[model samples]
Target: MKKKILVSACLLGHKVRYDNGNVTCNDPRFLKWSEEGRFVYICPEVAGGLPTPRPDSQIRGKRVVTGAGDDVTKEYEKGAQAALKLAKDNNVALAIMKQDSPSCGSLYVYDGTFTDTKKLGEGRAVALLRQNGIKVFGEDQLDDVEKELKKINIL
Candidate 1:
């Protein structure tokens, strides 16, 4: 059976971002992955009931909070759980996500000060998925993803 990959919907050109935009990629491998039918897309924030064009949030001392000081931890947790469920249900071992997003960033996220400060931390969903043993990759790490695919014999 082909191994499935959990990809961020925004990476697939979906307008499921907080700013109602997408971080679409046109990489050949991305298209190839889609052609191979191994892509399982999800927008955790959207799945967790957050609206499009919603307020931008960041990781603030273990809690997710909007720039305006509104708490969105529950929503982030809900989204994280939803992402995990989707990955597990589809038997996914890999995920390619957006960078620097509070919901999908696998590398680093805002430090909640909203002054463009960044910290070395994974987003809520990325952390949860990693805890579940899913190898998460940032969009810039597609080459590393290919390496991982070979490790799992999915390439």
Candidate 2:
């Protein structure tokens, strides 16, 4: 049996982003994985009850806040927990998430100013997943995904 992997819903062409848009990838491997039913999709923000076209949020001093300065740390934390539950329930070992998102970003995210200045840090969901031993990757790190899969005898 193939290993199950958690993937961002937007990366699979689902319109679950804060701006109500999807960040679909056109990679053959992604397509193949989808076809093979190895991908389990989830939108952490949406799962947390946030609506699409919602305000952009960023992490500020360990709290998640919206662009308009509304505190949404509870929602972000809820979403992260939901995502982690899904991963654990599905026995998912790998996660491919959207970069720069407050919930799913695995590498870097925008600073609280939202002026496009990125900071090196993992998002809430990514950090939680990592803490629970789930390997996480950003959308831009397909090469690293392949390497990790090979290392674990899944490639």
As a whole number from 0 to 100, the lDDT of residue 50 in candidate 2 is 93
lDDT of each: 0.89, 0.89
lDDT of 1 by residue, 1-155 (tens): 55799999998899989999757978898889888999999998888889998999988898888889899899889988999998999989799988898988888988889999988889989999999889999988999998999898888
The C-alpha TM-scores of every prediction are: 0.96, 0.96
Q: Worst ten-residue run, lDDT, model 1?
A: 21-30
C-alpha-based local distance difference test score of model 2: 0.89
Q: What is the lDDT of candidate 1?
A: 0.89
- Which ten residues in a row are the worst by lDDT in model 2? 21-30
lDDT of 2 by residue, 20-49 (tens): 976898788878878888899899988888
